[model samples]
Target: MRKNKLSFQERAGSLQEECLCFCEEASREAMFQAPIELPEGFVIDPAEAVTNVTWNADSLSCVSERCFIETGPEPDEIAVQFAVRLQGTVTLLVSVSPVRNQYGQGNGAVSVIHSAEIDQVVYYSDEPDDCPDFSDIRIENLVVVPPFYGSPLSVTGTIVLVPEPDQRSYVFTANSGDSTVSVIDTEVNTLVSNISLSDIPTDLGVTLDKAYTYVLHGNANLVSIINNETLTVTQTTPLAGAPRKIQFETGGEFAYILAGGSSIYEINISSQTITNTFTVSPAADDFALDPNGQFFYTTNSGIWVVNKYDIKTGQLIDRLSNLETPNVIETPLIGDFAYLENGELRPNVVSVIDLTTFSKSSQINRLFDGLITIVFSDDGTRAFFLEPFPENLTVVDTAQHTMITTASLPGASDIAVTPDNQYIYAAQPDDNTVTVYRTSDYTAVSVIPVGTGPAAIAM
Candidate 1:
C-alpha cells in the first residue's frame, strides 16, 4: 500500500473544518433539547485580585487565591501556596488550620483549607466508643447504679448533628417534606443557628472547608448559597429545567447544579451568580465526587455508565453509561467504585462500579419495595436504604453484596450515617420521626420524633 502525504495547507484546512463541525453539532444538539426559557444569570469575568494567589510567609495563611492552598508541618516539607484562576466572583474558602499537618508530618495528618469540615464528618464516630460504659460495681444479678442510660430527655423527636469535627456541624431533620440545614456545635451537639433561605431546602452540598453551604430547592428553580459563618443566605443563583441536585468544585470556586433535563448550571460562589453552563442531560437525581476533585459521576436519561466530568471545566470527560434502565447513580467513595442504587421500582439493587475500567464489579438486587436512598457506612462495607409504602431500613453488606438485614423503621423517607459511623439516622416525614440506630448491632439506639415530614438526611 502506498501512503499519500498531504500539504501543510490542506492539513490546516482539514483541522479547522473538523473543529467547526463539532461546534455546529454541539450547538444544534443543545438548541434542539434545551428549554426555550434561557437560564436567568449573566456571565462575568472574575476579578484578578480575587483570583490571584497571595501568600504571607510569617502568618502561613494563604489568601486572595482563586482557590485555597494548603500545607502540613513536616521538618522537610516546605510550605508552598498555589491557587487556580477561576471564572466568576470571589472564592469562598473555609479552612481549619490546626487539624491539618503543619508540615505534612503525621501518618493520618490532614490540613484542609476549603470545605474541610464536610469531609471530616466521615471521620467523626470511627472509633468503638459507642459500647456501654460500665464503671460501677454490680451486685449478683441487678445493679441499680443510677441506671445504665443517662436520661431519655424524650427529645422533641431526634435531630441528628453531623459534626464536621474540629470545625462546624450540620443539622438534618424532616420537620418539613423537604430538609432543613442548621449549624451545630460539634462538641456540645447543640444547634447554633439555622441557615435561613427563602426557598424550601430539598438537597444540600456543603463545602469541605466549612465556609459555605449549597441548598437546592427543586420546586423553585433556584439555589440558595449560604455563608457558614454568618448562617444567612448570601446569594440566590438560578438553575435550568428546575434543579434536582447540587455539587461544588474542589476549590469551592463554583457550584454545579444538576437538573432533570440535559443541562448543568455553573454558579460562581464568590459573586453568587451563574457564569457558565454545560450539557449533561437526563442526569439522575443524585451524583458523587472524587476526593482529588478530578472526577464526578451521575446518570443521564438512564443508568448505563455513570457520567464522569472534569471539575475544572464544565466538560464531559467520560461516561460509564453501561447501566441498564432504572440505575440510580451515586457519588464515588474511597474505593475506586461508584455505588449504584439499581433496579426499577419493584426490584431495587445496588451495584458497585470499578472506576479503573468503568465496569460493574458486583451487583445485588431484591424484591424489596420502596427503596429510596442509599446510605453507606463509614468503611463503605455496608449500605442502608429505606423501603417505600411501609417504610423501613434495609442493610446490605458490600462484601457479600447482599441485603444482610432489614430493620423496621417508623416510616423513613431518608437516612444519614453519623460522621463517626456509630449511628444511622432515618427521617420519617409521614409520622414525623427520626430513627437512630447503632451500625454495629443494627439496633435502634433512639427514636426521636422530629419535624412534620422529613425528606432527606445528611451527615
Candidate 2:
C-alpha cells in the first residue's frame, strides 16, 4: 500500500487551538514518533507536543503551550525567516523463532528503523509586531538568523544591535596639570562643568553601573569617587601610595588600584576600605582588567614585561616577558586580547597578547612615533592611538593587525572613542581644544575648547 504524505498550509494568525497531526499506516506491533526543533527566540511545551522539547523563554508560558515567540535578542524590523525540519522513524518488537529464556519464558527485543527527514516547516516573521502569532506553530526543521549583535564602529561596518538607552552619555576629561576634571556633553559638543580636586588626577575609572567615576590623584594617594549624576565628589578614599592606575571590576563592587609603585590594593567601593593588598616587584606603568574580572594585566616599565595576576588572590598566573618599556595597556570590551603600547625609547610597536594563552600573538608596528595613549572602539574592531610628537592619530584594525589610516590633529595628546562608537575625541592641550571626528568618515565634526592641559578622557 502507498503511504500518504502529510502537509498543511495556513495564513498568519493568532495561535489559538491550533493542532498539527501526523498519521501513517502501520502494523499492530509497530510504533512511530516525530521530533521537532525550534528557533532561537521560541518555545514549545512538551505536554502540548507530547515529546522531549526545549524552550526559548519561560515567560511565554502564559501565551500558549504550543506557541513559540520572540524573546531573545531584538529582531530587525525587516522580515526574518526560520526553517524547521521534522524527523520520523518506526519501532517494532521481534521474537526469534522458537527461542526460550532460561526461566522458561519467550524473549523478544525492540528495534528501531532508521529515521529519515519527513517534513520541512518554514516560519516567517514578515509582520511588524512584538509577538506575532505563528501559524501551525509545531516543532520540526528549525532555522534562525538572529538580528545584528551590536552597533557598527564605523559607518561602513556591519550593523549591530545596541542596548536600550537609559542614562545620558557624557565625556569626562582628567586635566593632569590643572587639578580638575572637565565634563563635556557629547551630544552638544560643549563643556558642561569642571570638577575641582586637591591633587592632579592621573587616571579615571568609571563604574560598570555608570553611577560613579573614580579619579586617581597621582600625588595625593587617594581615589576620588564622583557621582556621575550630580557631578560632585561623593567620597575620597585614601590609598597606601600614589596610584599609578585604577581599574574597576565589571560589577563595580570593588576597584583594583596599582599604588605605591609595587603594591596592588583592592578596595570595596561601598565600605571605602581596603579589602586586600598584594605586592609585586618594581612598579607597573599601566594595567587593564579582563572582562570576566578574574585576572588583570599590568605592564612593568623597568623590566619590559606584562604580568597577569589573579584578582582574588593576587597570584601571578602568567607573564609575557621580553617587552620594550610597555608604557600603556588596553583591553577591548571582549577581553580576549591585550594591546600594549611599547614606549618610544624602545621600538614603536604595539604588542598584541592573546589573553587565553597570555603570550605575544603579534605586533603592530610603524603606527606612529612618541605614542601618547590608545583607545578602542566599543566593539573592539579598531584601535585609535595618539602620537604627540607628530601630532597625529593612527587607527589600526584589530582583526587584521594592520594600520587602517591616520588622521592629523595638531597637538593630539589623548584619544577617546564614544560608547556608541559614533565619534572619536582627541584632546589637543597645545591648542587647548578637543576635536571630534565622525567614526564613519574620520572627518572633523566639531571642536570644543577645554581647560588647560586636558590629558585624559573617559566615556
Weakest lDDT window of 10 consecutive positions for candidate 2: 152-161
lDDT for each residue of candidate 1 in 41-97, tens digit (9 for 90 to 100):
311111210111111112112112211111111122111112211121111121111
For the record, the alpha-carbon RMSD of candidate 2 to the native fold, in angstroms, is 19.2
> Candidate 1: where is the Cα deviation over 4 Å?
1-168, 174-196, 248-254, 267-275, 282-286, 290-292, 300-306, 317-322, 365-370, 377-382, 389-391, 397-404, 447-450
Q: Give all TM-scores, in the order shown.
A: 0.55, 0.61
The candidate scoring highest on TM-score is 2
Q: Which digits, one per residue and each the tens of the lDDT, describe model 2 over residues 1-459?
A: 011111222212322345322212211111223222223333322222222222122122111112232211122111112222222221212111222345535433212222322222222122323232222222333222222345211101110111222576677878876888888888789888777777798778777667778888878898888778657676778877888777777667988888976888888887767899988765777788886778987887788888888888888888877777777898876658888877546446788888888887898857546577777777788888777665367788988778877777777767778777778887776776788989788789899887778877777
Model 1 vs. true fold: TM: 0.55
Against the reference, the lDDT scores of all candidates come to 0.50, 0.63
Please tell me which predicted candidate would have the highest lDDT against the true structure.
2
